[model samples]
Target: MVYTMLDKATLLPDLLRRLDKLPQGHALDLRTYKRNRSVLIRRIGADAFDVTEDGFQKERFQVPFSGLKKLLKVLFKREFPRSTKIRLYALGAADGDDLPTGRKVI
Candidate 1:
């Protein structure tokens, strides 16, 4: 059956309540360039939290958006487990050679 706008609207309050119960880090980082393309949540750091959505669902330590769901499943409900990896891409030459684009990593 098709869902009505009213249905989603009714669900919004509960969704917001669930979101609020999450840790500050669990708030989706809409500020990130990569996440601008989709609707997703993001966990910023390693921390455990008790999240209650609506009145029926209660989850702990939920993570946010991931390019790969595998990472989310494995890392679910845990703060920064071990070390967090960071990735960076730079401009290359037209021939895909390592060009001196003058970009450097800190």
Candidate 2:
């Protein structure tokens, strides 16, 4: 498969779409490089997410899927806002991934 890069402008929205399709209890972690601030979003219910934010302040709360967007804005825009553009550090489950294309495991 070809590699496609996503910018901040597109990353968040694409992430939301993937989150919407994720199975319950699965988590998607979003982190920034500056302060190592990251938000862990876990699908706890059909319409809710269990969120935890860290870096500037540590807090945890549950919100509807739509609320996840607002929460991200608050943290990334208000709390630890960055002045320059950079990549979104997502997909924690793939940390140090090694498998290449067309490889499947059962």
Candidate 3:
């Protein structure tokens, strides 16, 4: 598999778009550069997801599709502030299995 490196400017939107296209029964794990703070997003419904944060609070909550973007922005700012690198992994996923996934790095 090939991985595309994302600079600070494009990482946010790219990650948001990728996460939006995630298929059902799939989960995406995102970790900071040092693997210090992480977030787990599990799709549970067409407009719902279980978001788990392994940061200071270690909290988990359900966020709707409408709020995903905002939530991501907040999480990124809070957990990934000043981070120069980020790692993302999609669990139980295959390359080229989905249209968006096929075109984007995963």
For candidate 3, write residues 5-89 as lDDT tens digits. Answer: 4565677788777768878656777776666677777787777887877775577789887888888788878887897777776
Q: Backbone clashes in each candidate structure, one number apiece?
A: 5, 0, 0
CA-lDDT, candidates in order:
0.27, 0.60, 0.68
> Least lDDT summed over 10 consecutive residues: which range in candidate 3?
95-104
lDDT of 2 by residue, 1-106 (tens): 1222346666667878878897775666565534356666777789998777766787888899878887777766744475344323333332213211121222
**CA deviation > 4 Å runs, candidate 3:** 1-5, 93-106
lDDT of 1 by residue, 43-82 (tens): 3333432221211122333434222244333322232222
Model 3 misses residue 101 by how many Å? 24
- Give the TM-score comparing model 3 with the true structure, all chains together: 0.74
43: Cα error in model 1, Å: 4.6
Task: Give the winner by lDDT.
Answer: 3
The window of 10 residues in a row where model 2 has the poorest summed lDDT is: 95-104
